[model samples]
Target: MRDALVKYGFIAVTVVLFVFFAATEPAFAQSSTMFSMLKFASVTAILGLGVTFTMVVGGLDLSIGATAGLAVQLAAMTMVFYNLTGPTAVAAVLLGGVLVGLANAVLIVVFKIPDLLATLGMMFVIQGAKLIPVSGQSVSSGMVLRDGSVAPGRFTPDFLLIDRGFVGPVPLPVVIMLVLVVVSWFVLSRTSAGRILYAIGANPEAARLAGVRVGLYRGLAYVISGLFASVGGLILVSRIGQGDVNAGASSLLEAVAVALVGTSVLGLARPNAWGTLLGALLVAIVLTGLTMKGFQYYHQDTAKGFVLIVALLFSFTLSRRKVRYTPAT
Candidate 1:
């Protein structure tokens, strides 16, 4: 029973909440509502996946939110300031993500800094540096520049389609999120490289002794994380059609929470894309249900905290009990 609880508890809780919401709010079961929930979870899921990569390599990226915010700013600037095309904006944002990831890799892998401290410092740098170009202003269509001239470009319709467009009634973001989940799941759960990452996480010295390039894989993890963050930020700007300075304000908290909750999913106790998706869905469901019940914005955080605590309990408490009592095979 304890083992089952450890493995299925989070999933069970998610289903219960979903059912409760559906029963109490008839609209919650509607296709539109479900899609909307998925859409909202998309960015959280992507960011969580990026964080998962870092976790797999025994590191945590505190700078993902800031990196994503930088993407948002870059994308917005490309279109709204430089009057560039949608494709160009995307290229620029993705490039920015790679650079940030490389910087983080250098800090942690080359400089021998602790992962948390390195990412934390990077987070601060990105948050401040992203503002310098716009002189600390959000990017939007026709915004006035520092030179006292009006910026002329608008978010191209093609760019907005990334957020608003749907494929056979499903939101594009949801589809994108699902695609990322599938690909990441395959990479982490099926491949030798994935196994190497887990090995590194479990024991870097042991992995190094086995002839694995520990630094290389660790650097790769951060790069993957950065790419994921960039995509998340790109989706955000596309959805809002502007670059809000605070675009990623809550992203760090939400991303980290989902990634942590994901560790408890299926009793994996490790970062996995499928678990991250479930975690994101759980958060989205809670937030959407609370909103439908007329709860204020701040209350959503409390609900997320409650869910996370329960997940941790199910993951750690029961697993310990199971290990303590089980007989040797």
Candidate 2:
């Protein structure tokens, strides 16, 4: 009984916070605000879900943030500098992300580097490499008027539409996020690779003894993480309509927080898609509530930090209890 209560405490806290904010802020429950929150959560959820893959394998990829930024830069450069079409630009962006993941995998698995150090070094490399092509300048498309005259300035209908356009009542980026989330969930829960990943995370030696190719699965996890980060980068580009050097700087931190939080929900100590989804929603709600309450941006960061610390404490306490209550052989 005590174990169950402790394990579920975070969910209870999340609900309480939601109710409290909804009561205090008149606009908290408003339809428009709700939609806006969902939009924000959708993006975070996509990125968070990607990170979950790495966490499930008991590995971490600090390069995901930089990978996302690189993807954005690649996409924008393809369109603006290389004069590539949208589809081609997207393909190149995703490919770049996967290649970055491959590099991380090589360093960690083949070269026997620690996951954290390998990914951290790769993060810096990705950051520097992304800046070289654009010379650290934001890339934007040029305008083409109806008369086929190209405007000298760097703003285009295509670029702006990427950020602001929608399909019917749904935002395109949000729809894309949903599709990715569903795909990620399916891959993680219904596939043999997913089971191998969990087994490795739970016990690498045991998984190896069970005939699972630990190195290959670990490498694949990082690749999946990178690919998902690319998807997030594309959505972010669609949201902002341009490539910013600092585009995904906070993504890694947020993704980590979401993955950790997911571990506590439903007693799922390993990464689960639904848990990540809920974790992302929790973050979005907290940020949205703070914004609605007129809190400063810095205060929002502080609040997030506090929330993360509390979640960690709660999860650890519950985990200890579970370990203690397990029957001894």
Candidate 3:
């Protein structure tokens, strides 16, 4: 009974919550509302995937949100300031993500800094550095530049399609999120490299002794994380059609919370892509339901925190009992 509860309880609770919201709020039952919730979850889930990759390597990345914010700024600058095309903006942000990830690898793997501290420092650096080009102003169409000239470009229609266009009946962002989650799940759960990564996470020294390139794989994890963050940022830029200086400010907390909550999902007790998606869904439901129920914006955070705590408690406290078995004599 305990094991069954540990495995299925979270899913059951989520379903119950969904049903409750649908029953009470007439608007929540609408198809548009459902898609809107999924679209919101898509970005959060992508950011969570970034954190998940690092977590699998037994490391934490505090810089994911800042890296994403930098992507947002870079994409906007590419299109709105440099008068470049959407593809150029996409390429710019992806390159920026890789560079940030590489720098993190250098700091942590080569320079021997603690992962948390290194990423935390990087977060601050990125947050500050992204503001330098525009003199701390948000980037948008027709914004005045430093030399008293208005920016000549705006977000191209092609770029806006990334977030706005629908494939059949599904939103593009949601489809992207689903594809990423599926790919990530396959890579982490079905491949030899994935096994090696888990082995390293379990015991780095042991994995090193077993002929695994511990440092290399760990570095790769950070790079993947950075790439995911950049993608999330690009999606955000497409959605908003401009770069807000405050973009990605809330991403860190939301992503971290999603990742943490994912660990215990389905009793897996590990960071996983499916679990991350589920966690994102749970959070989206809570926040959207509260909004429809007339709850204040500030109270939404508290509700999210509460759900995370409960999920974790079930994962850690209730699922840790030992099962004793006698070996054949």
Task: List per-prediction Cα lDDT, in the order shown.
Answer: 0.90, 0.78, 0.89
- Once model 2 is optimally superposed onto the true structure by TM-score, how far is the C-alpha of residue 170 displaced, in angstroms? 3.5
Cα lDDT of candidate 3 equals 0.89
Candidate 2 minimal-lDDT segment of 10 residues = 320-329
Between prediction 1 and prediction 3, the one with superior lDDT is 1
Clash count of each predicted structure: 0, 0, 0
- How many residue pairs of model 1 clash at the backbone? 0
lDDT of 1 by residue, 91-207 (tens): 999999999999999988899898889999999999999999988989888888988999988899999898999999999999999999999999998999999988888778889
* Better lDDT candidate (1, 2): 1
Tell me which of candidates 1 and 2 scores higher on TM-score: 1
The TM-score ranking, best first, is: 1, 3, 2
> Which candidate has the highest lDDT of all?
1
Compared with the true structure, the alpha-carbon lDDT of candidate 2 equals 0.78
